[model samples]
Target: MGVAAAQVVDPGSFKVHHVMFTELRKLVDRIIQIFPKIEAARPRCSSGIKALCSLNSAIDKAKLLLQYCSESSKLYLAITTDAIVSRCHKSKSLLEQGLCQIQSMVPVMLAVEISQIVDDLRAAKFIPDEFDEEAGKVVRELLQRGASASDSMEYAEIKALQTAASRLHITSLTAILIEKRSIKRLLEKVSDSDQQKKKILRYLLYLLRKYANQIIEEQTDDTTDRNEGAFGSNDPNTNFMHAHAFNVESGLENKGYDSHSDKLSIATLPEEFRCPISSRLMYDPVIIASGQTFERIWIQKWLDDGNDTCPKTGMKLAHLSLTQNATMKDMISKWCKKYGITIQDPSMQPDVPHLLETSSISIASFGSYINDLRLPLDISNISLGSLDASYTSDGSRNKNGDGLNLAPEQNSDDLRRDHSSGNASKLDLESLSSLAELDWESQYKMVEDMKNHLESDDLACFSMSSENFIEPLIKFLSTAHDLHDIRALKAGFQLLSTFLNQYRSGIRCLNEDTYSLLSLFLDSEVTKEILDIMEVLSCHRSCRSKIAASGAIISLLNILHSNIIDSRERAIKILRNLSLSTDVCSDLVCLECIPKFVPFLQDTTLARHCIVVLRNLCCNEEARASIAQTPGCIGSVAILLEIGSHEDQEHALDILLSLCSQCVEYCQLVMDESDIFAALFDVSVNGSEKGKASALELLRLLRVTNHDDRQQECFESSNVAPEDANNHAKEKKSHKALFGVKFPIFSKKKK
Candidate 1:
């Protein structure tokens, strides 16, 4: 058996026991060679059937090995599986075969299996005297290499054999039988010989008889069950109706070949003759020049109704709605190359069955269909409250907080209805003509009256600036905007913004109405101007007071974050200023601003600005500590190291060092996360002497903690335990300067 296995690897041999497996591998290589020559070959031969068959066979073999290894413990199982897999991968065109081999090895990885053994040992408290120490060492190495079971083993085949031997108590010879069974089963499926078919039938019959009765008994239930559907079962034909129906051999009976044809003679070709493209009845097919290319006229007719292309390869047919057959042909060539499948003609294979299915358009196209069926226009009516702030802005208030001029004002609807004849709020240009009867100049004066009254900066103006009083303000803010009106528009929004911020959380203020006013300034005309205002407000001591106010500087910053029309540099600059602000930075942190900042690190244009801000924040002990605790800050630190400028790296090191000083163990915590250590390697190596000194110091601090725990023992020491000396060496390496400070030995030590 071993000699036969050895012969399978030779490309020239076909008489080996593994002949089927060897042929499949060679077939894949030949298919790969023919793939590029497809365009020049004869039609109906372009479908890369051979390559696909080989790939499928290799995958089946790998799956078999995995199954056999799971069920049996034997060294021969490992050896045989490895030998067959290695044979499958000896050619460049066998990528699919190699992938299958790699995938099979994953289940047998020594690192993974050993790790599992260790876990089982710990769980069951099983420790054979000889295996205990070696098992512990294996576990430690596995952890250090990231717990990948396969990675720790030098050879996956060896690992598989060893694990099966240790855990399942089976000899290597028995393992070989399981592997042989798997290989035989695969060959049974691929072979077309009558003898092979009989053998397979006998094997399957044995398996079914052995398991059928037990399976049936387990499925029997005592509990009553409801009917799942209208699958009435008494009539014999009821099942016959559900059984797959086949049409008579298409196009042949019409040709007077009725001698062997029954009244409705049906032809069932072997499974291999079924069209891989459209598995149904084949039709008018003409062979094209290619390895596996075939052109079928009326190809679209095979794809059920309303379909135009092949569902599997997206290939357009000779008679379809395709705009360009040549373009589609090119696309099909690329698709075949990607999947390594040959193109087959539906018409030429008259004996083959081509199955019909619905067209496989992308799901996104269904949404387009729904949208196309929607109404062309929609109308909705909304009622908004009156906008007036005169009570607080223009009205007189005394020391007792009593209103001096409190009078009811006319509602906008009443003015529009009594004088203009309808709701001017709902009016478009056509409806504006109905307002001709009203004193237009006087109505404009009333708007002026409302606008002036809402601009007051005092808290007494809260009532007039309430959300109900801001309707007119919203209308004015929503005016026809252009660069010409930008300054005027910015001034209006700024006033509305100021009024809302002062009174937003107050009893009379309407918070929702404030955002409506803020949205108007989102126009590109004045985006820059609004960001400038945000920058100024961020600098204000009073900015903190307005943090709870509706849509202040933070709102502006959010708008900036979302606006991509302008370079993100503008947004980053504004955020940098806000991040630097004593009043805003703390509030920003409280808002958990790391998510907003992290993406900016990825933006090449805004990255420098973001890094500067991060550096500055880290420079402050409190801010750096707070940022370190952010959800993604540890990952963000690694990113910053990869892309940050030299100065930024130095500053980050300083912050980390300061954090270490304040919390001596903090350094160890960050170092424990491998990603953080990886990040530091980029930044800590090239800094100035002072900066490098601090990094080394932080490293030393972490080492001392390791020393105290006796976790490592790889350093030189004569009297002290190796583990203790390892701790000392780590700490010493961390502080080169400190290590150089030598201690004197007394002359009495010579005794």
Candidate 2:
């Protein structure tokens, strides 16, 4: 009979209760037959439905049957379910049974289509309506029965629900507890079990966080509506002070009560997904907002382009991307959905309840982010929001509009280039001897020898086929002690310059760090000869060598600009010579050094050299825009046109033509000045071929000048505009304008 009954019911289509009832009916008859004396001794045999006791007693009876059933039988398991339910109904334990039933049903439904069936059962007429008025009440009351029993009960409940949830493969349930107030209270009651509490807390917190923004937004809207009618017109700010005077009245009068099932829904999820960390729901979701993930290279690029969160996680990072694990993404999604919130993906794809579009900052393409801060530096473990001052490679640390940290680290090479007063001056006789650990006499001797050879023209240049002589001179300088003696330092500088002149490979061999150091020495060395030596070194075989040398000169200029020098006039002369060198001129233009030297241009001795660099930069297509931004660049061009010898006027005109062709904004800067047009016409009519060429170039630039090109040019220039022209220009008409600046004097800002 048992075999036939099992075969007759299709396990796939049959309800668990229907199957249980059928098996129990057959099992009860068998029990009666097998122990007829036992049945007669107790009471008259009744129908299987009437044979069950209280829920606890029925469970005890099921355990008794389990002991006798020796072998696994569908009938035995089925009988246990029937007995438990019947006894639960009989003993007034229906509420607890419903709670247990829902707990089991929800997780299983995640994998199967049991939600409909579970809902029907939930609504079915029971012995009493309010018997299960509260979801966690039964478990809470059962706690007073015994401490261990309560603990065991909660543990088993969490385990059973979690096991079912895993089978259902519904990860979202883990965070629902926080949304249901009753379930939250139930969790609070079981706070002694830290692990269980954490599981509940993690899922609940997840739900709360997901819905937090939406709730706030809704509340804000409601507030605005309430104040609108009272204010006459709907200016929100007008009622702001009085708005808080009114409060939201709480009760069932105006809102639907959070249902018991809703509270249970929250309780049920954490028990479903075994927390990956503890094989239980997470106790505390790791708050990873402050570490290396916050300071990702790719993330920072986004922030610089106006981004405010992780591209993948939608957590606010602002121009900085934090590196995080892929698992976190899945977890966050589940949490968000449970709370009916939308979290945008890094790709800006919508994924959630409201289906709201992400902000522009969040949806920016990877290319755009990278383009914002184009210069590469080592910036690991530094978040845009919580960045450390020491972590940046660029000298200045500033926040972008998105509130992301955008600071570049100071490279060792940069330190060498900007020879500012305080630190360099301190590196004198005592410090040098200590830092290098060599006597001053030996260093002086090497300098003397190098000087004599250079003066007599006896130093042999290294052939292209052999090792570079410039490299050895650099190494010697690194260890040389004569660096302390001003005279010795000058001679060493002279020797280094001579090597630069003799060997083409030397410039390429020197790393950025060495270049910076050389620049620093030039800026700080207390002698004209050393300054002269730097001028010679700044010259190279071709424009490329000169370009590399320009980087070094800029670094030196940056350092020297900060400190007052006794021989500022001589130093200006050397800078002017270096800027005029065609080889390095274009590099200076691209690095934006010309603009930075604008203020110095008015320094009669320095203005001419600054003009030469700008002229060369304007001539080169790659650097024209940078030169155009120079504070006095436009005025300089005008002055060059209005007053100069024929050759000088031609040179100025040549630069003007280059600037107009390559940089529209620069043309606009020139056109904006009233005197500039007249000067261009004057140069065009009265000057040489070069002067006319320049005037024509200016006209072409003005014609091409427009909003579109200006936006594209500045936006595409770099993540960091390393140099600013107004910062280095003459101040007579200096000013700030949209899209950065018009022109400022170097007096307020320097290299």
Candidate 3:
């Protein structure tokens, strides 16, 4: 004031002072208005609002100092202004700190309040209108931002809301508000510097996966219980589901409930928790008409990809509509809450767009693509038998050069008669020629159609003439011997197998040329098909002779040694059928097929077939003697009597009876086993009528043989004459004297 008086207070100085005072007044008024808004936004918790009140008190004290300074003298004004400036700076500092503190706590406080509201909603507990409106507002605000557009702050808010909703078990609302794809997008958007956001996203995903897994488990348990009730506790199918569920539960337990702040990695997530389609945790699951449930986005994308069928079932979609799986969504939410993982808004998910170019690809183009990737053409070049080497040059001559030319005018009756006589039908020849000219793809399709025909229509397959097909089939096999043309060979074998299986007379159609071709295939790589063909061929007496003569039995025996069950079964079946013929049985015996057949009796599935073969072989004395001489043959059959089925035991006992009846030594061999008598007794009492009769008869025969042998031994030992006894004693004394002399001579030689 003294300085102002001395200077005579110029207009510029007065104007500067006025401007300063005006600006200060405006600042104070603005802060006054801001205080109430800050108070209103402050969290309702006592701790949350304490900082805001302190900030308000500081601002009020500064305002009081400013108001008091306007009425004071210049000197006093200067002192009061200093105090006001100090208070204003203090209040400004406090306000900034309070704002940050409040902002930090806002998410937590909102989470708590919203959780309460959600709990109320879930329990159907009374919620005030204001509380309901507030929760709805928060949910709407979080969902307003698209997942791709949302930043870290918005993501945090959405996560808080989702956590609350999930805790309340409001699955439908949670799914609607926070989608899985949106969380993935938010996670992707998080930069390296934003580790907090990344962590939050990861935690939210963990919760999603955990809860999804739990829901799946609960549903699985429910389903298993229901299935157990419906199908009974012994259902094998339900055991698989229970095992899978247990594995998933065990995985979750091993993972434990890690803290949300800890660095949980994606690799830790269980694969079963992931969607089968996307191979990620399911967000919004929907059930398709096929009864399979998948995440909505992926399923929708699959539908949009021009796939008109369910991926799992491959059944045509009756309708593409997805039914919301509310239960799964609830489970995902609860899993997150249990593990302290925060969930983000559903709206933040990214849009999974389909590739437009895929729709333009055609099946024909796809086939061409496969063809381009096929093995090199030169690899298919192999020296196959020439068509002209065996068949007529003009295709008009038969094997004996009997010019069996068929003109186009030949009637169906003539064709039938020729086919019945094992000659190629002209129609079949033309068909085979046409088939040979077709491409590989066409040929494969034809073969598949033929297989289907064989499976579905036995009469049609039998009625179809094999003559035309056989020649072409033989030609096809010879030409397709190259590894590159394996499909053609496979198809040819399949057609041949079907032809032989359906029509017994079809085996006769194999002339010398065809027989040689078929014999060559018996040693080829397609053993399964060839075995099946041979099995059918062995059904006919003439074919069995031809096959045995061609030395195909060796190939069949080789197949029996393979570890493959189907091939072994088929081989045994063929041998069993062929053994019905005495000549074949003798050949089998010479070839040592008995040892191979013996071990198969242990297998329940093959036991019946094996016993049949042995039974047929036993018809011939040489074959029976061969079987009885084989090691473990009698014991293996004895085991079958103990453990085999009713039919098996019957057959096994019959084989044993036949073998033992052949010679007393064989009966003694069977009787020597420790458990043979017990097994026979058990079978006699508990076995089927046929089995019981067989066991009883065998038991009686064994007892009679034993009685006779014992009687003969006793009769010979007790009925010795006195003169013979004296002679025997003299011979014993002479044997002892010779041993005594030899002992000294042998000892002297060793010394």
Candidate 4:
């Protein structure tokens, strides 16, 4: 039996086996050579050497089995061969396990190596060129041998090789099976004669199918979880599937694919076709940091919710950015197209770029036309208050010849009646005619009614201003006399002030004509409200020059001289705003307004604004000298340094610095006031960095110019002898003159 068995395994078969083992050994050696590179690429992969050892052992065992089969004729050779085959199988299994660990861990570079090896083996059919002659001889000898024995030997050898190949092949295939089409193509190329390889291919195909199915199930579970609050069901598809089933049954009543039929042809989609989060078909799929794919909206929501971990793996995500899964999206798109289902891509649509370009061009063209177009025509013809035709002379009509009436002085009863009726007349041609015709009392009553309406509902103010009523209101206020038309003037100013407060456009409507009218009333008793209106108007740059031109600075300065504290404060603020313009500041100085701010400087509430106004006025050299010459101005500013806030101290110090910079007398004045000098020194020690620096700079300047005078005064004040004072002054000069001089070390010297 041993002889027959040995003969049955032909010498040619042994030659084929020897060549096969040698090639496999060579392949293993090539793989081993790459191990160092692989290990270097993935030092954290601890199983690299273990995997290599398993593969090497399997290769060695296969060679041993082949050698034993070729050389021995012992009766126990078959038993020994079976034992070797079992060992080789075990080693191959271990190699597969180790390779799987390495593949899972070191997927980037090592995976490329394994993929390349698999591709080469599969393309070459695992047969080296050196084994060609032996392989041919083995085929001829197998033909000469009886069919049964030849078939048995061929099956054994091919089975062993297939087992080894399948184990290693799976490690490579498993890494890339997520690409369903690629896996399918590779499976189709596997040989049918090699059962082990075929089995592996089928198993991998099963895994890919299972993975796809799991995606659908996972999506369904997520959808169910999301809808559970509203639907009270574990299955999200309960309603959808039932409705779909009903629709199919109703629509295809007698068709073979009816829902009622047990053999219903339902399409089974792959898991990759659905989103892991929503359990719906993905229209815009994206990949996250965990290498899992989900719908873009669902994943974005997850990130927005402040979850920094991946839902699938519980791994902390390194990044919240999502990459578009273009491949998966394309696959889903193709599948949807085949099924005649429309899918809306959440990304920018195909026409979006063209639409955006068109919009931008249209906007640019419109802007260009606007730039070329003339300014809009002045629409100030819209009348604001009711007009009574009784006061106007027929020839003295407004330019528009609108027969506008200005309301005449009616009794309080008439005014109350007109307001209660809610019949505020709109501005029109007749109203303009009556405005010119109306007497002062009638105009007064008309404005009084409008003021009442404005106070009750401020929206009335918007309507009145929008109608171009500000011009008429300003004209009436300007023309009304302070003594006789005081009520009419107050009413008109009140109405205009409301317009200024309620609408910025109203302030803008105060053109040169309106400002001309405003200038006439600067000396009116209603100066407080007039100043209030000017304050709002000053905010607009266009109105500032007009207000300055209108002699508003003189009026504001007069208000500052008023005994009313509120009036003074408001006057100071308006002056401060007006002082922003150098021209306006010059105007204030020309009006001798510098002396007016001096008294207010002692008022702490008004000190900051007063100082600020003075600061602006002092920008001109004439104004600076004027401010320094203003009695008590220098003393008040110096006092502010001692008791003011940090900002006030900075401003005061700046004022003193400016004054001293201009005239040596002011510097001497600051030095003569010991409080001022002490304040400067104190600020140098304890003020803010900028303030301290300025204070130090002032002290340094004072010391440079008046050092001897200051020191002599200090000596005289302290009762030091004139001789010592002279020596002290000379020593101080010498100390400064010396460069890098160190003082003598003072211990209790020679004690």
Q: In TM-score terms, which candidate is top? A: 4
Per-residue CA lDDT of model 3 for 325-416, tens digit only, reads: 88877877676656656543321322322222222122112212111111111211221122224221433432222232223213555445
TM-score of each: 0.26, 0.30, 0.38, 0.39
Which lDDT values do the candidates have, in the order given? 0.38, 0.39, 0.54, 0.53
Tens-digit lDDT track of model 2 for 171-224: 232212213332232233233433433333333332232333333344355544
Superposed model 1: Cα runs more than 4 Å off: 1-487, 490-525, 536-553, 560-568, 615-626, 629-632, 662-665, 673-685, 688-690, 709-751
Q: What's model 3's TM-score?
A: 0.38
Question: What's every prediction's RMSD, in angstroms?
Answer: 33.9, 36.8, 37.7, 38.1
Residue-by-residue lDDT tens digits, candidate 4, 280-376:
5778889999999988866775676568988768889999999999999899777766666665553321221111112111111222211211112
Q: In candidate 2, where is summed lDDT lowest over 10 consecutive residues?
A: 355-364
Best by lDDT: 3
Worst 10 residues of 4 by lDDT: 1-10
Candidate 1 or 3, higher TM-score?
3
| lDDT minimum window of 10 residues, candidate 3 | 1-10
State the number of backbone clashes in model 4.
Answer: 33
